[model samples]
Target: MLHLGLGSFHRAHQAVYLHRLIASGDERWVLAGGNLRPDMADTLTALAGQGGRYTLETVTPDGTRDYEWITSIRHVLPYEPSLAGLIDVGADPRTRIISFTVTEGGYYLDGRNRLDLSNAELASDLDGRTQQTVYGGVAAILRERMRRDAGPVSLLNCDNLRHNGERFRAGLLEFLERRDEPGLLDWVAAHTTCPNGMVDRITPRPSPDVAERVRLVTGRHDAVPVMGESFIQWVIEDDFCAGRPAWETVGVQMVASVQPYEEAKIRILNGTHSCIAWAGTLAGCHFIHEGLSVPAIRRMAMDYVTDDVIPCLHSPESPSPIDLAAYRDTVLARFGNAAIRDTNQRVAMDGYSKIPGFIAPTVRERLAAGQPIAGVARLPALFLAFLQRWHRDELPYAYQDQGMDPAAARAICASADPVAALCADPVLWHELAGDARLTAAVRGAFDEVHTTFAGALHG
Candidate 1:
């Protein structure tokens, strides 16, 4: 296994799952971790110091907490020679699968959903000098594999993006299409399998208090102990490049197609996070737990789910019919977990990429059905307002421990002229602005919520 972007979430979720598999005598797979970004150097250093062993801590229902020592990762490799080094890593015949939790924006695809070769960051990397974008690295690797006739390797994408595997393949193909190689893209299309996957694990960054708690549990001081809720679910499309681990033995739902599950989760679980994160932050709540404690905010979130999200799900025809109430309760319990310390800012980060999958799909579906998106409409508008506030330097950036810079955030936020950003970014505004009614609804809700939320926060 070659795991890219070895961050806290990946460590606590997929890596931990593999660790559990290895612990239970499935030691055939070991992770050779790679870090693309610079901050992860410290994380790599920490994990390497401990021989790639780290603690995954979780909060329990009865106020007790527990920790597990995860040791599935074997080695760390920095991108020393940019694309060349990454190609070398991927060219290894023994590495049958490459998994990524590199986040949504990490792919560096442009608005047309093609490889953003024009991107300055991407152009620097593709020049093969010393730059290293995920696309550049993956493209370079695929080119080498095509050259060396290396056996197949699956590309497992564990992010929340819809049709992730298809997107990864498309992004890669877009890059390859620019090259003059004969039968290379065809060979890749025939060999490489990019599996769409739904990965859910509430791995929140641990606070200093939680760090001390880690010391009490493991007797070893861990600088970065990932605190997650006990709940986890992975639904994956049943496809592999060379082959795959017996992930089904553990708990993954390996299906012929993960589309239905992916659609359901992207709209419900991820959408709910967006709904609360912005409104929660604007309300001056420090974390999701704190937000849930607020009656109005909590009520709004529940209403949004029940009135808006639940009706859209493809439930079973059985008598049970998938109890949405039960699911919502579970979500509430997870969000309201005080010990988990899931921050609004952590959830609120990456609104640019997150909105298209989580919120926009529902809005688009509703518009197609000629249904008003009142309950659904408010959250997006509130999020936009939050973005404006986050931009204007009015709010202190939450979840700083997890790669959120207030200055950079402010700049991104400042770039968001709701009218301009939406019109320009099709991933967000194309479908949204196309619906005049929805756009009006969003603008109206934005005005009302912004006033109410701002007044409430300031008061």
Candidate 2:
């Protein structure tokens, strides 16, 4: 199999599953890692250096640990000038599925729910010179496969975005259309399969300390040993352009449709994470699992989910997709795992683009149903206020790197007034403000957070 964006998530989630499959003696599928980002060079080199073997440490519930050795990937491929070979491989009948873990921003869409043609990075990518965007490169590869009459292949997206595979298809098609790639678009629409998927695993970032600790534990040096929660879940659509592995054996639920699972995950797991991360960071807390360890903060989180979020779920009739009691317990346990010191900043980054798309939809649903998002409503509003402060250079802590530049954030937030500025951008504020109740709740909550946080800092 060909895996795009071979980052920590892929190694911790998909690779582990594939490793289990390989241990059970399935050898047809092996990952070929590719990246358009130069930053991945070190990580790619480290894995390639290790001979595609790494330790997977499962942070257990009772504070115990279990380790497993994974060898699911066989090779790594650098993003070369010409992606012809990559296309040829995907087109080859032997390849069954090609997966991706490209983050939410990688898709680059504007507020209009249309492809962002104006994206400077995206424009640069289509020039066919530098590998800039994932969509452009993916389109180039897909087009080549069509030209060569490459057989069917399923494209699976493991990202947190809603209808991720569909978004990938749209993004690729948009690129193809803008470039006028001829019948390639039609062929992709008709032949290629884009399977919507839901993947959940708490794979925390590995720092030098983590790497050192892992080495001490395993008695072997690992440059990128992945730290994650013991719990893992994967829900996938049964549709595949080429065939698929018996992933069911490895805890993959092959469903007739993945829409419900996607919605459930987005609204529950991802949405909650975004909320906690954004709000927690502003409140001087870092790391999601850490948020659960504190009583007041954990209470806020629980209230946000149960009192505010649960009422707004898709099917009030159906049982909640996640085991609420178990999830709360697991979250607290995961946070307490000192091995997985998942930074709050890591979760809090890119809030300008991440929050609305991930959690606002659920917040909107709750509002539409005339439900009071008492605990949940404040999250987005507070996030916006936090974004405002972040942009305005008013944050308590210092952020030196480029991930979420307070300066840029300030510029965006300061571009216009709060309600007007946010409401103007559909991507940021439309849904949340559409409901009169939510608008007021968010506005009031934003003010409350500002007041509360300000008092905590100054008083």
lDDT of each: 0.73, 0.70
Scored against the true structure, residue 342 in model 2 reaches a CA lDDT of 74
Q: Which is the leading candidate under lDDT?
A: 1
Clashing pairs in 1: none
Model 1, C-alpha of 185: deviation from truth (Å): 2.3
lDDT of 1 by residue, 340-399 (tens): 778887888777666665776677777786877777778777766776665555766733
Encode model 2's per-residue lDDT on 253-275: one tens digit a residue.
99887876676566666666766
The TM-score values for the models, in the order shown, are 0.89, 0.89
Positional deviation of residue 191's Cα in model 1 after best superposition, in angstroms: 2.0
Q: What is the C-alpha RMSD of each candidate to the true structure, in Å?
A: 3.6, 3.0
